[model samples]
Target: MKPWLLLGRAQPPGGGAELLLYQRDSEFSLKADNQELMNSRVYGSEEAMARLGCQNLGKRPGARVLIGGLGMGYSVRTALDTLGEDARVVVAELVPEVAEWNRGVLAELAGRPLDDRRTELHETDVAELIMAARGDYDAILLDVDNGAEAMVREGNNWLYSLPGLTAAHGALRRGGVLAVWSAVPQPAFVKRLRRAGFGVDEVKVRAHGRSSRKGGAHHVVWVAKRG
Candidate 1:
């Protein structure tokens, strides 16, 4: 049972708490625990598909979106590729080191997404971006935590709470969509969106990257429309 060692941290784009990176070596024989998702880069494979399912919606011209995380920029890159030329994407990433790692080791890990022109990385918590949006976005995608059901950080609870959902509702324009990427099905969160005055749809998308195959993690995407 090797122990996981802390590698480092860095400042993100919009300015917020730093991203934490760690590695567990069997040599030390220490278990990583429940924090496995945060400590390791799970941006590839099924998670990438789960997080990027929003792109299935045909590109909307003049569409403006806010992305809640920037793990390896897979979601951001996918969005840029799917959206029309008139679209703009603002990424709210909580850790600067994560962003830097995306540009550094993680870039080589998942291919560089920060280099994309359509993305404006904000190295800040997605909560701040949600609070300040003010009907400015056509779509809001949240990938923070493991989903609303499982939180990686204690502070992230604020983002999935009632106030946080209300804030997300206010950020969207009429007929705008608030899309959430979850690792598992959370029917309660879907109900919460309806309570917040959104027309909700719990879409189960493919977990594998660009594939519609079976036998992979289900990407439970909560699609809610404002107004």
Candidate 2:
């Protein structure tokens, strides 16, 4: 059996906690204070985050997408694979070192997604990006902070708040999809989506691929559509 080796540590700009990156043979993981945040091997839900949103757009040329949380670049790669040639994917990563990890050690994990010409990397908060844009994106995929529950960063709760949900609604084009990945279900969030003028649908996906449930935990992704 191979042991997990610590690759590096990153200090989040928010200045609350430190993120530790570890590698175990071919797989990698990001954790904070010994709490597992994201794992490279269990990315089915992350891929679903992009798939469920981009599928709503249906190969639209020049579709613009915003992905929050560049964990291992799974969602970004999935979006690139799901969208058309002219589509642009803007990935907002709060932690700078995560991007460096993707470009360096973890590049091959998601097929070096950041290297794609259609993809842009923003070393900023996704909330700020959502607030700054108006009807700008065809889809907004958020796999940040274990979803609406908000574990990694205390400030990430804003992304799931009523105002944040409203910002996401305003940031999307008409009929655009806002996909969110969560470690657990929050019924209040479903209601907030409706209050924010989004038609919401929820899907439960295994952390590992559908072929097997590596663990019993099932992650949920909320596909909220703006009209």
Top candidate (lDDT) = 2
Q: What overall lDDT goes with each candidate model? A: 0.67, 0.89
| Candidate 2 residue-wise lDDT, 154-187, digit = tens | 8888888899999999999999999999888989
Error of 2 at 31 (Å): 0.6
How big is the positional error of residue 122 in model 1, measured in Å on the Cα after superposition?
0.9
- C-alpha TM-scores of all predictions: 0.78, 0.95
For residues 1-227, write the lDDT of model 1, one tens digit per residue: 66667665543443434445665651111111334343232333324443444454445667788888876566777777667776778988776666766786656543565776777899787888899889998788887666785344566777777788889999988887888777778777777888888888777765554444457655577778888
Clashes per candidate, residues 3 or more apart or on different chains: 14, 0
